[model samples]
Target: MCSEGKTTPKIVRGEGGYVLEDVPHLIDYLPDLPTYPNPLQDNPAYSVVNQYFVDVNDNVAQKIVVHKSSPRGMLFRRAGPHQRVCFESDEVHACIVTCGGLCPGLNTAIGEIVCGLYGMYVVRKVLGIEGGYRGFYSSNTTNLTQKSVNDIHKRGGTILCTSRGGHDTLKIVDSIEDRGINQVYIIGGDGTQKGASVIFEEIQRRGLKVAVAGIPKMIDNDIVVIDQSSGFDTAVEEAQRAINAAHVEAESIENGIGVVKLMGRYSGFIAMYATLASRDVDCCLIPGSPFRLEGKGELLEFIEKRLKENGHMVIVVAEGAGQDPTVESMRSVDHQDASGNKLLLDVGLWLSQKITDHFTRNKKMHINLKYIDPTYMIRAIPRNASDNIYCTLLAHSAIHGAMAGYTGFTVGPVNGRHAYIPFHRITGVQNVVVTDRMWARLLSSTNQPSFLSSKDVEDAKKGATDAAVGRGE
Candidate 1:
């Protein structure tokens, strides 16, 4: 058998078969199991691609394009194969990195990746890149092994740590080559995934054989066509606790307004789902649905009416809500994070102040408003049972896809199945709440006014008609 320096393995026809290459480093850490000829020999799926041991020219295929024949359209990601195999078990050296903000399931995903690579592929040289993209060029790396990460899933933050910004793709590629790494598993959100695509392209340009795979990790649940990303379910569950607290605080006082601000840079799935789960929410405000601040039966009138009838009310607002039309004029966009996401204005606090002013000016009742912003608390907790399982499955699928030679794609849940999707298709897009279906349900359950002004009512009617015509109803 040929070594790493050789192009291919030499086949011997006279002998019973070609000898398996001796990779002592890969086998030294594993236990001897004489009873089983091969741990994965029985399963063809996990068998080595170079079983024949012949010299063949390197021929890489084009990207794996999945096509479906359904009128209603198919799952954005569907079941598929990698179309090519890049590396064998022993010759592969892999690295796993996490980027962007904190999420509930980050640690679990890390543990799953380490365990799957070591246990399934017997990969010994697995390194953890620290502090996101900066860790690639810097001297910050953590050695990963099966025993080292056995109980990491029980924790919250990433074992390798993470950071934003610092997207030097060329330097990152130099670091990968310097470390002799052949496969990379990146767990992050949209911005981080875009950086991964650049790194993958640079590796190809350098004539190096490296596989890059991404596991989508959006807590906002805003990646298009992905049914659900890791950490979303856990975030929704944690937000419910805050909503419960708001309900209690609002009920204890007279004319109380419990305001909750959730984390959503440009989407509002967290706020929407939390409000839906906690039926105590009187009004749900999101980035997708805009409401009037003044006029007959508007936000002020709705709160006043609710106070007169029930004496207290709970209002849930997404951080990105009411920004474009209402809050943008009142507030200035001065700051941005390392990941390039604009720092949102404090909508919850602004709304609370406005409510207090309107009530004080009326001189009818006093306003006892309670503001709750639980962004950090929700993002720091360990993964719940559902998210833990979801993270583990995503990690396994990522390892399989990376070893199978898939590049520039992220593993996501599509139609309740783990599927690989190209990064470019979903990078700039967003998964928003369907107003007609989801907002209609929220309005019905909360009994809130659909539209506060004449213009809003006209827009709603036009939207309904457009939707009906599209659906051929």
Candidate 2:
């Protein structure tokens, strides 16, 4: 089933006892390809380690805490230096491209990839695709080396500029073939990973000796099959600063209300985590949870009650919250950007206005409201300590997998262990905040209403959001 790319993903499996979400290898098709000793076997840095090469059949279990009667469940190929490799040092020509919007660890990921290929494998002749998918055919390539990327990790955003849409798979594959590129690295969010999957399919259909590797990167931490993605820690850390500022402003005045809109695309992870960390947020709103500003399940009434108790309150809202057609039907936008994403209503601005109107005119209460939309700021900063370390692990894992001739795979931590996941298992998938222990913790910290029914909470745990904030389908 893995050889033909027909394995069911673990998260969606209902009745299956157990499954292996294995990735593809060059030997699956090019059976006659010769092997070479891993370059790491002689590297001094690795000689100090107790164990290095991972066994070929080694895998990580996706679910460890199953019922006594349940099977071992899904497993993914463990990521590490393989005992043997297929690509020789000189024949490996690699090109990297970053797509979608800015993420905190993008530059760090790019830097680690370049350094891993150069320092460990001694692979020269690496190219950086200038501007996402279109960069393959439309723009020039930048020569990448350890020296060039040495200080990039200290910077923010991708050194290789990114963009949205304009994903021409044919032309991009053609460029790969024309340039004799055998290894491809793509870094992006969910939509970009979907594009990478199509590119992998094309390469497979053509029977090319190419390896396409995806680094699952979404600052929202909404990609499925992984415990968490890079940039999430950094985003959460940066978001706390905004929450702190908002708290200061709210507490310093009478009848003060602070509204902070966080980025979760179609989910509520960022808002949820930031609110939990702040400890001052009185309310939090996210998608898949039914919330109404007005009605029997009134959020405004709760806000009023909270203010009466504390004299000040902070509200944290996910970008995807309040997106119900019934709430925003008249203002539902039909326009899309170049990436073809549905332009969502700015819930922050509208909520601010609603709060202002309800207090100043509707209730005849004078109030001071501060709305902070740190959507771009949080993601645009450099990677934090934890995320930088995470980026290093992901980058090296991807480099090792690609160099060992693994293709059509994405690298990420599954159950806190790095593993090579197939493109089919993760593409078009989204991970949402569930009413789990963590959500319960957030509720306790914020002391806010559940804002959702039991069924809606179940729906939130179903999976990732279909429509991202600014990216395409």
Candidate 3:
């Protein structure tokens, strides 16, 4: 183990900005665990590669841009194949489970994991836990094979079939121990990953020789510490069709307003990117930044101004935008889903009705408004080319980390470099639009006002900082 890879694993440098926290390893508890040659060494695929294995000391810097006086900043363990592994191929039995909502690359992620374990290490007996975490004890599992998941990447949704909030840590671990499963691959969002972290602690406390690996999945792009979520690009790309359609609908009529709601519960990456990509958006709203509905220089005023200027305008709002209960009694009923995520009101419907009522009752003018909600459609499709390649890399990285005895961690890219991120660093928090260059660029592209005030900017900045600090970014 490296010097900084202590039990606490904390390293600080340069005015407390730089941090290095190593991921948990099997050696931390079971110090006598022996090492074996990595199975990739014998495979012909990586046989000729000279600089293949990643060093134990190799770390990816979290911050790319820092002052000259600043230290190297936070660093993460660089992810890839290791020259040595803690587990032999024949002794490994892996199980995969996909939890939370559906994302575009779920099938691709599942397929890649099965294929990577089966083809690279020749580890057979991979099982898929169907119906989310409950399937572990529900006896609703399926055997996974390379041939069984060969073409699953071309399909949409997860082949394992997913649900949310069935995380019974004790029962799940009991099932794992009974089945003799050693490696556990869990794919899901923040809540699901939080569950994974708890499971890891339980397994570690019981002194089980189990490796718990996580693959972060969220189309919302909210989970912090990673560059972006798995299906973010696909969601943003698929949103264009709705944006274009809204633009056409708005432009086709007099006093036209097209409202397209996208999927962004807490973060607004999808809505912002979709609005930026589709130049037809006159206004964009997200949950990170607050806005007023009816007032001087408010959202209604902006809509009216845009309509007067262009004769037709488009507004793009994330599903989670304007969720404040004080915002026109929009959220009268506050309910949560099985995963504990708040069930959001249809902002598109509420916003469209507000615009219609404001025009008809207040202004005594007729307006044509069209609402397009493509939230589920965007996430339910197959992964695009970008996500396909990314999911493959993520799957491979997770396999390598688990084989190298790195447990209780999730795998993702930090500042364009893939690294193993500890589960505690990423779960229960989120990454949101920081109202920095990206938000400014989106506002400039849409020609929209700040909508709220300097408070939103400050709050967004503070949220970004808090997330960075929480994730050790």
TM-score of each: 0.81, 0.92, 0.94
Model 3: per-residue Cα lDDT over 1-473, one tens digit each: 00111124435344456467678999889999999998898899989999899998888887899789866667888999999999999999999999999999999999999999999888987999999988988999999998899899898899899998746678898999999999999999988887888888888988999999999999999887789889889989999999999999999999889999998887788998998888889999988778888789999988888888889999999888888833447537678998888888888898888889889888645689999999889999999999999999999999999999999899999989899988877765563455578888988898888875787778877877776676654
Which 10 consecutive positions of candidate 1 have the poorest summed lDDT? 1-10
Q: Residue-wise lDDT of candidate 1 within 11-99, one digit each (tens)?
A: 21223321221111111222231111222443465566554211222211112242453122222233223333445667778899999
- lDDT tens readout by residue for model 2, 1-473: 00223433434233455456678888878889888999998999999987789988788887778688767677888999987898888888999999998999999989899899988998997999998888999867899998999999898888899998856788888999999999999998777777887888788778899999999889888887787878999999999998998999999999899999998877688888888877878888877566877766579888888888999999988887887743464456466766666667788888888889888777656789999999899999999999999999999999999989998889999889999988776655453545568778887888888878777766665532433321121
**Model 1: residues >4 Å from true position, as ranges?**
1-39, 42-85, 325-331, 452-473
lDDT of 3 at 310: 88
**Global lDDT of each candidate:** 0.73, 0.83, 0.87
Ranking by TM-score: 3, 2, 1
For model 1 the local lDDT of residue 176 reads 96
Q: Candidate 3 has which clashing residue pairs, if any?
A: none
In terms of TM-score, which candidate is strongest? Answer: 3
Is candidate 1 or 3 superior in lDDT? 3
Please give the RMSD to the true structure for each candidate, in Å: 10.5, 4.5, 3.7
Ranking by lDDT: 3, 2, 1
